[model samples]
Target: MTQKQRIDAFVSLGNFLRSDDQKLDILLDNASIKNPWYTKNNVRKQLATLSANLTPENLQNWLVGYPDVTVDQTVGIILAGNIPLVGFHDILCVLIAGFRAQIKTSSDDAGLTSFLMQELITIEPKFATYIDIVERLSGFDLIIATGSDNSSRYFEYYFGKKPHIIRKNRNSIALLTGNESAQQLHQLGFDIFDYFGLGCRSVSKILLPKGYDIAVFFEAIEEFRPISTHHKYTNNYDYNKSIYLINGDKHFDNGFLLVKEDERLASPLAVVFFEEYADLAAVTLNLENSASSIQCLVTEATIETSIPTFPLGGSQSPRLTDYADGVNVLAFLMDHATQN
Candidate 1:
């Protein structure tokens, strides 16, 4: 395939995933087996944005960056189920780069990914030879695995000899200047509540300016009351509320959610914690401790030269081509292909 043809194939892949508008609706509406972490609109939003990001022009530029990747190698992927269809990028990257993908789909979030993959193969039947969804993963040249901290340890031990990218549980955080507009802080709700805060990119903590009032934060989030209407989310909120209060754990009340002041990255859903900071430098040092478990940081204040910054809600809706490890995926995949 010509470089443009391969790039067009990727764009078509995204189009295929987005084309099943009705099926997408049905999956979003009823795909919840029992514990639902996503809704149709959430899935739709992700698909729409990711689709736009994989445009032919962008994919072509991506191909230019990698000048040494060989397309013949097959990559095995162990996907995470923390959020719905979270591992689509990995599949897309492998195919776009010209290698076949051996996928181990997560049982919890497999419905949509399989559907999308089926669509991709339909768009270009040749993709069938490149994509395999398997129950058990075996031999492959490279591996990309996402799992919990414990599972990541196992992945590293088992796939240690191969060229692999293994990801453990990571959380996102927000850096508050305490001067954010109500609109900006309200958008923070998307960071905290999207995908019911189950995605690795969901903001689980806020680094606050010293003596910041929790009242303002709660007021900003009040507009996002629609999120509470989801049954599973409400249950998590209420159940965790009782456990923490009964245990006398220190947490700030927000009427709809809870915030506790702490130095940790992972917090219960419908709850967020804060850590006061007098110096951004000091906060930067503290965050380094959790960097492995931290996915992205949302900030209103100027990030210190050392801290990474992404837009406030970019966590929940990452671009399709934004590969993990700060790598540009399409570039990585197409590095070895000679251009037409």
Candidate 2:
């Protein structure tokens, strides 16, 4: 497909997602059945955010930096199913870069991605030949895969010989100055509660100034109490709360979420780990040491640090340029195109 054709197809898809059509209802129902974590409201919110970013202008701006090339290669992608449509961006990148995508969808998220792909094929029939949804990925010039650290070891053993971008487990963190406004802190709740903290960009841990009042942070996020109502989420919350209580661990609980002072980057679902920092230097040093495990550092204060920081609530709504794991996917594909 031509550049215009590709842009038009995505724009049509964005419009379709924005419309109040019954098709979305059906898709959401199927998605929820496939994975209870994909509640209808969560799926709808995620799709709406993605659709807004799929505008023609955004697509053009994102593509303008890359060299134009006509190349045909099969790119195998192993997608993660942690959050709703988490792998859509990779598929979009592959198509826009003029490569055929052999996608192995995570069983938890296959229905929604397939539905969107069918919509795109309807908009531009040529895409039907460029896209393939497969049970297994093989015979590809290059590969991009996302999985946990354990699975990444397996991916490395299997796909290491081929040029690939194999992404392992990474979690996001927030740096709190203890001086943020109520609104900013409230928005931080979305960073935590959205997707039930399943995505790599979700803030699983936080760094706070010494002696910060933890209660104030809890109060700011009271609006998100409804998250506890989800049966699956409530089960995790209750189970974690019981473990903490039975073990005599001291942690703050607001009945919906738990805040524990732990020096860990990866937090359990229904829990947000926090650490007290003596100064900016300490936080910077800690982040530098943990660079490999951190995906995003959300904050409002300006710190002289190399870690990429997004404002509170912006982690989940990444622009097209926000490549996962800081890998320049377009450049990677374009370079392969040139070599091929």
Candidate 3:
């Protein structure tokens, strides 16, 4: 297929996702029914984000740097099922770059992705040859796997010899200046609580200016208290709370969330770790030291750093150009295409 045809097909797929098809609703329903973590609303929200970005203009702009893939290599993608459709962007990249994708869907998210891919095939029959949903990935030329740090080692053991992009656990964080307005803090709530803090893009920690009243931050995030009602979230919250109380550890607890001092980047679900920083410079240094473990930053402050940073609420709303782990998948694919 020509490059224009492939791009046009994706644009059509985008438009199809935007439509109010009953089948789409049923897909979301099944997704939530099968996996408690994949709530119907969360699935819908992810689909909306994908549809919004998959436009003709966005597709053309994102692909302007690369030549058409004349080679017919297949990419084997091992998707992560932490949140709804987290692997869609990788699939989109593989498809738009004119490569076949042999996908091994995460068992947690298989049904939803299969349904979406079927819809894309309906939009463009040519894609049927390009997309292969497989239980065992056998005929792939390259690899792109996402999983925990431990699992990433397993991926490297199997796929390291091949051209691959193996991703590990990475958490997002927010920096607070003690000057954010109430609206901004409320917006940061999405970064912390969205998807019940399951996605790698979800903010699990916050860096605060020294002696800042943590209470203000908690008050602004009260709107997200509904997240506490979920049984999984409540179970995590209760377990963590009991542990902290039993050990007599110092912590701040709102009705639904847990906040405490933690130097680590990753936090447990329903818990937000924070560190009081002497200055932005120290925070920058610390972030630089831990850059590999961080995915993105959610903050209003424009501190000088190479790590990707998002606005208060933009953590989960990554644009089409915002690649995960700051690795441009398209660029990698284009470079691979030239070598072969």
Candidate 4:
């Protein structure tokens, strides 16, 4: 299929997802059954974000920079299942670049991506020839894989001979300059609580100005207390809280979430790690030191830092061009497409 055809099909699929379609609801239910993390609300939220990003204007803007070529190579993608529809962007990149996708969906997130691909084929029958959901990813010319740091080693060992992009574990963080408005801090709660902070883009840590009142931060995020209603989330909160209490570690807990002074970037679910900084220079130095482990940074301040920063609540709502791991996916695809 041509690029326009691919774009049109995706746009239609996005519209169908936004509509009150009973079939789509069933698909969401099935997805939740396969992975409890994929609750109906989280699935819908993810779909809505995907729908917004699939517009004709956005797709055109994203693909226009790449050299168009109709390369007939199979691209193998091993998707990550940490969040709902996590791997759809990779699939979109492959198909839009005029290549075939041989996908091995993460077992935790199998149903939704397949359902969406079938919907695309229904919108444009030609896409049926371009997409395949395979049990084993073999006979492919190149590979793109996402997993934990340990799994990345396995991927590098197995797929090392082929052209590949292997992504390891990464987490997002936020910087608080002690000047955020109450509204901005409230929205920052969404960055932490959305999808129960399962996504790599979710903010698991925050850097606060030294002597900043922690009470203000807690009060602003009070709206998210309902997140504790989810049993799985509550269990994590209770477990982590117990661990802290038993160890006699001093932590601030507001009954629903825990905030501790941790130097680590990746925090466990139901908890957010935070650190204090004296100034922007210290924050920038720390971020630069941990750049490889950070996926994105959320901040409202204009700090001079090399890390990618988004507004307080915009981490999860990334645009079409927000390639994961800071890799230029389109460029990688085009470079391979041009090779004879």
Candidate 5:
């Protein structure tokens, strides 16, 4: 098979995972048995974006640029469980690049991704051997691991000898102009609360203008009533609230979620924080210092200078298609073949 054909296998797997008629809803129902973040609406939304973004055209472009790629190499991924199918992107990336995938799925998200991998094998049987689940593996040519800052230390020690992409915890941020319209602010709500603010890409904090009314932020986010009502989310909200109250820490209330005022990148799952900024230049410097642990940033106000940023609601739905560290995946894949 041609390289594009193999990449197409990855695209087809994505489409199959997203099929409305598939048992995804059922799987999500089972997941909700453990954590109620698997609400039908949220799962459907997640699937829709992931499925739509992996179009045949996009997949073809992804492989076409990688002319010398091989299908025999193996890449290992230690997936993260903080968000649904968070590591699926890396799985598809390696597979589409014509490499075998040694997947160590996070326990919280393994079932659904494993089921999808099974479905992929059905589409093209030979591809089945290219993917495997493992309790322990060491033969991989490249490793892509994601973990907390603590676990990253062990991953670095163990896999430091190999070509690796080891990701530590990171969170998204938002820049507010205070002049944002209600619609723009509402989009910000999705960035913060989607995935119950568990994903690294989810915005955990915002840089608000000084004296910016917290009321506006609350009013905008209240539109996500379904998100607030999810039992899993409410559990986090209540748990974090109790912890804060017990410790005598202060947090602003938005009825459903807590807003803490802090200068940190990541907040607890059910809570968000905001910091007031005096100047954009200072904010940029702070972000630069913290860039290693930062993902995407959202902003409404146009800056005189442009930096890395994403639209308001694009956090929870990055494509299998998006290259990590802003490097072109197809080019990198082909380079491996050329170098060898």
Candidate 6:
């Protein structure tokens, strides 16, 4: 299929996602049962994001700067299952670039990803020739893989020689200036609690000014206390709280989440680490020093920082152009396809 055909296919898929479909709800419900982490609500949240952004205008704007990829290449995609349909963007990138995609679907999220692609083929039968769900990825000119830190080592070792985009574990950070309104902090709660904080975009840590009142944050996020009702989330919260108490560590506990002061970017599930900053420069330097480990920064638009900031609660709803780990998957494909 040509570039316009591919764009139209995705636009149709977007409309399909936006429509009220009883089957889609059933799929999400069944998926939640298969993997408790893929809660129906979380899957729908991502679906909503895709629905909102997959417009013709958004796709056209995103592609305007890039050259049209006329070269035909096969891309091997090893997907991650940390969140519902987490690897869909990579697949979309390959498809939009007019490359054949052989996807190694995550065992945790195959049902939904499989269903979406099948729907795409239904909308545009020609897409069937361009997409495949495989048990093992092979015979591809390039690859894109997402996994944890340890799994990334395996990916690097195996796919090193191939032109590939391999991503390791990354956690987002929220920088607080103590001037945020209750509504913003409340929205930040979604960044922290969404997907039960499993995905890299989740705000695993918060940066606070010294002398900041922790209770203010606690009060604002009280609305999200329902997140604790999940047995999995509750178990993690209980385990982490007990560990802290046993170690005699100083920490603050809300019913659903634990807040502790630590100089770490990645926090455990159900726990959010925080560090008090005496000066913004020190925090900026600290973040810069550890930029590789950080996925994205979340803060108020008005806050001045050396690095770019994502508005509060915007981490999860990444746009089509918001390539993962700051690597443009589509650009990578188009630039390197000639060599392949």
Off by over 4 Å in 3: none
Residues 114-156, candidate 1, lDDT per residue (tens digit)?
Answer: 8777877776787778888988888687888889889989999
200-286: candidate 5 lDDT, tens digit per residue: 778898888788898987888787876666776888888999998999888888768798898777898778888998887787787
TM-score of each: 0.90, 0.98, 0.98, 0.98, 0.91, 0.97
Q: Rate the local accuracy (lDDT) of all candidates.
A: 0.76, 0.90, 0.90, 0.90, 0.76, 0.88
What TM-score number comes out for model 2? 0.98
Number of the candidate with higher lDDT, 1 or 6: 6
Clashes per candidate, residues 3 or more apart or on different chains: 3, 0, 0, 0, 0, 0
Candidate 1 stretches with Cα past 4 Å from truth are 16-20, 33-35, 67-70, 305-307, 327-340
Worst 10 residues of 1 by lDDT: 331-340
Which stretches of candidate 5 lie above 4 Å from their native place?
246-248, 304-307, 324-332
The sequence of per-residue lDDT tens digits that candidate 3 reaches over residues 1-340 is 8788888988988888899988888888888889999988788888888998989898898888688765589999999999999999999989888889999999899398898888889888988999999999997999999999999999999999999999999999999998899999999998988888999999999999989898898899989988887898899999999999999989899979999899888998889999998878888998988888899998899888888888899898888889999999988888898987
How well does model 5 score by local distance difference test?
Answer: 0.76
What TM-score does prediction 1 earn?
0.90
Q: Cα lDDT for residue 307, model 2?
A: 63
- Record all residue pairs in model 1 with backbone atoms less than 3 Å apart, i.e. clashing: 66-335, 69-335, 69-336
As a TM-score, model 4 comes out at 0.98
What tens digits encode model 2's per-residue C-alpha lDDT throughout 48-132? Answer: 8889889989999999967665567999999999999999999999998889999999978838888999999998899999999
